[model samples]
Target: MSNNTSNACINDSTNQINIIFVGMYSFISIVGLILNLIALVVFCNNGRTRSHTVVYMTHLAFADLLLILTLPMRIYYHLGFTGLHQWMCNILGLVLKANMYSSIFFLMFICFDRCLAVNFPMSAPVQKWRKKAWLVCIGIWLLTFGASVPIYLSKPSNQTQDKCFDSIPVFAIQPIVVLPTLFVGFGLPLVLMLICSWFLVRAVRRSTVAQTNLVDSSKISKMITTSLLVFLVSFLPYHATLLLLSLNRHNITCPMLDAHRYSLMVACVNTVLDPVAYYFTTDTFKKKVDMGAFRRMLPLNSQSSDLTRRGRVAEDS
Candidate 1:
């Protein structure tokens, strides 16, 4: 009787969590798809606007779109449709990881772009970097695609076909691969973003023109804060759980697996958060995609006016 009761409780919790996951992914994928489509339309229509920030953000949006495509399959699986083909799993897994890594790379470059423009407004190399950013984004795509190849080659030995995206085989998740991905892919980018944000703040404070350009300065601060919050909130727990996966690669537990899945949901939440970055960081996004338009899509509208108002207040001060 006791064992039966325990099993029933575990199952009840699982069912509730599954419902949440399904609903969460459904909402995120839908809104993310629409927002990213709008972003691309705006960027494409932004003729003659060759801003470095736009270049990085454009790629970031593209990456997000690709990543969002995989969410439906996840929702399908969560709905008890687990008999998916291995090839389909391989392809979705590859695309999902490739874009996930690419999104983070573009995010890192976006931070660096802002920091460079503010801190080195005169260097010839920096001036030339606008053109170079395109090449860098292309390279980011190639690198992430290459890095994620293992997912295509290695199949999940433990779980059935329905268990596609939830876990990976321990052998496939080699320590070398996992460690580097955790440190270099996530850790290094996080560190660089922090350092760049610090430099950006200092440069803004010391700017000879800052007294007159308070609005731009506030915009910079808001952009940095929004980007960092997105990164830390979405990516941090996922990577931390990823490391834990490595430590207990051999003796995995059900709770640990659940934690890993939940962390990944958090990361996917980045797709929605990316638009917030767009609103705060890019002038084109701010002016072209009005707060009212963005709000009609979601509650991000509530934040838009507050940010704009605060910037105006700073300017008035």
Candidate 2:
């Protein structure tokens, strides 16, 4: 809780490490900004007809955007151009937790939704159900923001110090913050997602679903890939590193701290990936999002069945 990242910790870490951090954020911020904005446009293009998946995916993009929009503040603070205030540290802590947990929860829901869509293709998609789902999404926003507040209790004042220089503050380093969130934020959601993936996998195996036109075979494949792959890539490494970070809090060496920091950079990759991966039914996805070269790397919508598409997710009404 006391800024475990001592002055020696920071100085011992090479300048090359700092350069990599800045370089990664510089690229991610510029490209992630443009992609996420376009994603918002695609998700909200037709509010009247936006489906349940759209609702969940909208929140996902929105959460990442909150983090994306604020990256410059983080970058400047890290680069030592600005000594971040205690108040700003608290605020950024909230924003960081809010983005990570909310996105985690939303991804779990999206997986469940996709499962239901594929499983219950003909089951009536309750209009009221979609309406009520928005309440759950709102609750997730409130829950993540609210829950992150407690960890700040353990942080040192650092009121007169370079608050920003303590890069891995209570949020990442404290057992109180890292442990519970690792369980609830990443572990629980990941377990739930794995279950959802299991069901969806069985659904995908049923080649009969494709022949009847009961479901869009390609769509099912896209949802499964996006939900599982993104959830893992965005969260798994960071949380794993965070776990190590917490266990080794007292003995946090330079390399371990650097590894944890790198995990964060990897987490930011989701922003660039989300537009293509999250929006399965987006109308203007291909038209407006000029990601053809990038799209090849991401292989969304290409149905390679038998390994292709899940569940009675009521269609997006």
Candidate 3:
């Protein structure tokens, strides 16, 4: 009777937490979807999308957008709408995991790209490769997709009413997969980002031009700082929770499980915050968005003349 009562209590607690998670995911889904969609339109329409930095950011926004697109099903599943087929659940879960990792890697790519640009401005090959950023982006997508396939295939079988994000039975291949994933997917990228940010900061401090242009220096610093903070704030907690869950799989604690769910929800906030990075770091995007807003507020003929006058004044200053 005591054992049964304990189990019942645990179930009730889990259900309550699941309800909270549903609310969190619903809020993140709505806000992240809207923000990423706007970011996609802005990045796609802007002429600056041709640049390597913008190219990486464009792909990053697309990845986040795709991830959030899967959130409605997740929210519904959490809210006890569990009539979904197991295959559909697996596919949706796989997409969420796949894009989450892809977003991390793409952000890493952006950091590395910026580091290269700042640290080696005159290298001919580095400059030439900027034009081939599309190739790099394609390669990253292919690599991320291939890495995700094993996890997708390893999806645990589930009952009809099972929560979509519930822990699955460990598969024989899961150890082989999870170990590398924990290290490679989370650890390595984090280390690389830190290294890149460190180098960027050091390079900026050393650059004479950075000293002359306080505004540019501030912008660059803000970009790197925000990127690092997002990675730390969003990805680190989730991955730390994942690591703990993986280690404690045999004797799972309810609090640890709740932590994992909450951390994952926190990571979703990255999608909403990424547009802020674009606004701070990308000059062309900032200029274009500003011009767009200005055009909307002014008459068509006055727009061109005003923009011309402002450009001349800026040059004079």
Candidate 4:
């Protein structure tokens, strides 16, 4: 095929992929949002306030919820929103980018927290360090908000085929956006999680030797492993694409366009896969869903005192 013909074909193929992903992304975003919202509600109502796992889950839900909130703008972009109330378009793009990237930080923190808990059970302040956790959560949001501020303020407005709006300042774009996110979000998290999982496995292995040895907590380990896997798989491609696309300057070539579209779809998939992982990993969430319970059956102050005591006992032992 001639270069012109090949380019046209590539353009058409890219559009087709975008169309398919746009609709799928919207649907998945809606489902993820609902599931995360439900998990949030259950966490709040069930008086799981004392559980560190619950706290992490709550924050994760918050991150996923934000991602869902931004989906409409994405749908608009792909569906072609022109003259979309200037402010609306800007806000939409801003929110979409912010939430999209912020989710990575949340995932990173969760991995770090889990790793700490698993590897240093005694030192890892699970729930007693709730204040610290809150601070960390606040820090994560603030840092991400600052990092993604460009997406909101700098996104090119009046974007059309002929017109252009640079989503972020070219100079402001740095490895901070890609390298740190990749390292912290996927690289560091994956390594730490693997180490944590290894230690957890060893812990479980030792448990088998003692008569009173607790059966392996396969549930939590499985959940963490699954979460790490999904997070790494779904996000690596998107970030990698961004890194490569960053090299794309004034180029509308087939390969660049193909990667750009594919990355977008992968990011969308994360929105869907995230909630599924959350639901599977959290037993409290699962129980709530299975029991069709929205409200707390016990008192608001109720907690698994025995479990808390046992956790403390186990650590002491």
Task: For candidate 3, give the lDDT.
Answer: 0.68
TM per model? 0.84, 0.81, 0.83, 0.74
lDDT by residue for model 1 (1-317), tens? 12333333334443233787899999989999988888876676553544677788888999999999999988887766656876777788788778888999998988888777776666788769755889999899989998788656765454445446654435435687888888878999999999999987887788654444433786777877888999999899988878887787766666666787788888898988998665435555666576343444455433333333333312111
Clashing pairs in 1: 82-162
Which scores higher on lDDT, 2 or 4?
2
> In terms of TM-score, how similar is model 1 to the real structure?
0.84
RMSD to native, candidate 2: 6.9
Q: lDDT of each model, Cα atoms only?
A: 0.73, 0.67, 0.68, 0.57
Summed over model 4, clashes come to: 1
C-alpha RMSD of candidate 1: 6.9
Residue 162, model 3, lDDT: 47
Off by over 4 Å in 3: 1-19, 158-160, 169-173, 212-215, 293-317
Candidate 3 residue lDDT tens string, 1-317: 12333344345543343677688778778877876676666566644225577778889988888888888887776665545677786777777778888888888888888777776666799878766878988987887888887777865564333444554324412457668877888788889989988887887688653454422566667778888888889888887777776676666556766777678788887887787765435655556566662354446524321322121100111
The prediction achieving the highest lDDT against the true structure is 1
Please list the residue runs of candidate 4 whose C-alpha ends up more than 4 Å from where it truly belongs after superposition: 1-18, 85-87, 124-131, 151-177, 184-186, 206-215, 250-252, 295-317
Candidate 3 weakest lDDT stretch, 10 residues: 308-317
Could you tell me the C-alpha RMSD of candidate 4 in Å? 5.4
Per-residue lDDT tens digits for candidate 2, residues 8-39, read 56555423235666777887788888877767
Worst 10-residue lDDT window for candidate 4 reads 162-171
